[model samples]
Target: MSLDFKPGAFSDFFRDETFRESFTYRNSPDAIRRFPFPFDRDEYMYSVNMEPHVPGRKGSVFEKTFDVDEHYVSEMIDRAKVLADDPLRCQSLPHMTLAGWDTLELIMEAKARDYPQWFSLTKEGDRWHWINRPLGIDHTFTFLDESTLPYGPFEYIMRQTQGDWTLQDERDGTLWLDAGVATSQADWSADFDIGMNFHEWHAPVPLAHDLGVFDRALKFLLKLQHGSPVRRFNWTMTVNPLLDTSPENYPKWGPTKTTLTQENLGRKQHLRVELQSLYRLPRSNAIAFDIRCYLGSFEQIVTVPKWGRRLHRIVRDLHPDLATYKGFIRNRPAMAEWLSKYDDGAPTSPGWWPED
Candidate 1:
């Protein structure tokens, strides 16, 4: 497919592919301190699928490397261990989903020229804030001429990609929500694909709720939780990348940050099952769930665990009376039971009143 990048979009100057490759090939260099990151050789790759949100927008395949060192590997594992131990850390939400965590494989691949120390640094916002500094990596990429060498080399270019996610509960075997998004970004850009999610828990004690958090939690549980695990997920794929102003030649596709292209079809899903901690000690230390989604929206939050049953509130796209699925959330049940109950036709009403 023809890329929409404008002239000079891929001018060379990105990083040290030649030098780094030569060093690694000749002496086996182990690590490099790239600003904004410290990567090992293993992390480097030719392609990357977003670990968090949407599918298809998996970003253009890379023919380059992301070299991460053992130190970086240790850090990533250490972080994953902590997130796994805390049930709330895995909650599926925007801020919590893999943001600030993993380097988006394709979305934001800013590398330092040589090392983090050599890059320029200048403050961008508040004093305490980390100023804008060269990530040390340049994004000038060049297209490959496959016919000449049968595998012409490729380079890294700054580009925008869209991502999203949908999470399911493992304990109750029910889908709690469906979250999605489309995004584009430049430097200071981000992409963290966290396998986040929520689970029904029966808290030994109920905690207090201010309006804001209450609304947020309710909104959290409002979507359909139809995912199983990263391995057993489902959804169609939305493969087309958005074309607007871009830094490459089409800065025109630079992303207005005002309007967004819409798509609900073609979303693919992945699911995985793993043992996780599901308790929060801060607020009463009652029962909680470790729900984390790889997409950007969902996050980890403490709530009275709703397990074994599901609420029966109806979900209406328009402004239907019930609007949300409170009854379904409240009645919370194991996924199998919920399916059985709704098998014959929806009752169309709560047990005691007309649901319509």
Candidate 2:
């Protein structure tokens, strides 16, 4: 059986006055624009498209090291729901305990510095105080003490932040998936991939491994500097506004991808983009990979004429195997057709849209 999607209902969320108002930074010079639309051209191929995490680079408003967007609270709530339903969605090996602590401290410090109003961290002797104003969480605990944070260091960090993170330890000339919490995965199992080498975990990716992209990425990651982080972009299609698309919940979301048709394409299909950041923790020397998921529907994305047409072109030119790997092969044709409506060759203004 297939799930039904109502275009009117789905479009309402994107068109809501309150929801659109949440995009307060849309016109600001420093506003991190929505839709870091990854396609550079009509033909899409994978590559190690990474750059230094310098703020305001290339005239971009993503001026902060960590991104805390309007969806932070809602996404964190969804993550908590997923973790409660399946504890395995958040796991860290015993060896990664310290790495987990390092990750927690790093993110907390970043959040406190970047968003001082909502998050604050202070230390008095060996005791640390973490204040999450948004969540109404205020607690004092011994720094690095497991008992101090009942949910564990990584899980505690995951609760306050928006993105999912993974700690990678460099050893034996390879990166190991040692620890961290991943609640919003793109059809991948963090629990299953735990303890796997970088290459082993990404073995299923078609040409990236064979083309030595992963090998080169590992080398680049290992040489990454402590304070200087780098970021990259990846994208796929999702059928819902849901964030917890990990393989553990595939039984629930996998069928929705197959349910896409011309009738429901505009409402059910969403362009899911991941703003992936790589940080080298100064303390543990562990590499922290953060995945921040962003979703926009065809209706919202079409507001930006360039993004709409570019997305249509990329999907039209997408390789069959690549589309299949991304779990969208079954409905790519319908999606392409639907996207064509917005590709009327209108002169694009090359500006950002709030909804996108």
Candidate 3:
């Protein structure tokens, strides 16, 4: 689990168009090997779909609890580029400074536990030291002093980890999105969502509000425990390999909705699976929503016969409202056709695939 990321690994990754192009293909085995394929049934629906983070899952290339995979360094580099392009992607309210420190401590501890060789943390009195060998970051800072860390406490933590994090504060029996960083949002805007309650933030989701899914989710999130982290998987399709698909950059990627055709469907379309984890900070009474995105194409998905057939059926049968909300109305038909052409006509049942 210990990866030695060279000093310029990220720069090298970004500069190499050929290396980046490798992942954009439909039959990239490397992508499929690590893909968090999100469908389990022919029909997809909204649900609470959370469970305790169990380690050593069989299908995924990385662990479910806290994973640092091959894309760790590259993705962090992508995050930095996005944040530089727009600092608004990372925000923490002044009152949430303490919560920010708590998040940093929690993430550092998790990194050390999961990848001890590459990451470590040590504390002596109020002075704490964090060492991230891969990033060549070694610094000592006062646990709660904003001046000691170059960036906001939460921002500093986000730089070292692969997942984008959001901290929700619990107040008056409700959870509010008080602080955190997000560079890889599905189509939502973290800046616009700040200060909104769980239900308000998820308002755009198709049937969650009508079916009381978000209400039940909010209740479950508020009752989450400190040691036990729960995770759920959500998926959407994007036209590009890029991760910064927030509403702000919609103009850049939004047009791809109508541009997809059977000719380019396999190479242009990607299934984006988000591994979202919810953790209750021990000290701040805040919930940390960590999102890690995994992308794969129909070419790679079809390699697994069941995944191909299931995805074809799901897209073909998806409710119109849900498909529209997911920004798939214009392109899904083309994608379904491409998937069907590649499918091997495998027999699949609803219970065949495991839930994330």
The best candidate by TM-score is 3
Lowest lDDT sum, 10 consecutive residues, model 3, at: 12-21
Encode model 1's per-residue lDDT on 1-356: one tens digit a residue.
22222222212222221111121111111111111110111111111111222222111111112222222212222223322343222233443222211222121322232224322222233111111122222222221222321111111111111112222222242323322221211111111222323322211112313224333443443321322111111111011122111123223332222222222111111011111112111212112222211211000000101100111121111122111111112112221232233334332221211111
Top-down lDDT ranking = 3, 2, 1
Candidate 3, which segments miss by more than 4 Å at Cα?
1-31, 58-64, 349-356
Shift in Å, residue 71, candidate 2? 1.2
Residues 1-356, candidate 2: write the lDDT tens digits. Answer: 11111122212112221111132211112222445666665577889989887785333326677766555555665667677788887888887778888887888887899879777999898799887766667788888788877777887777777777888988898889888577777888888988999889999999777778998988888899988889888889888666777788788777777777788777667788888899888767888899887777776676666878877878988888789999888888899899999787654443333333
Q: TM-score ranking from best to worst?
A: 3, 2, 1
Q: Which candidate would rank higher by TM-score, 1 or 3?
A: 3
* Predicted structure with the largest lDDT when compared to the true one: 3
TM-score of each: 0.18, 0.86, 0.90
- Model 2: pairs clashing at backbone N, Cα or C within 3 Å: none
In candidate 3, the residue pairs with backbone N, CA or C atoms under 3 Å apart (3 or more residues apart, or in different chains) clash, namely 26-299, 26-300
Candidate 2: segments with Cα more than 4 A from true spot = 1-33, 57-61, 346-356
lDDT of each: 0.20, 0.73, 0.76
Error of 2 at 227 (Å): 1.0
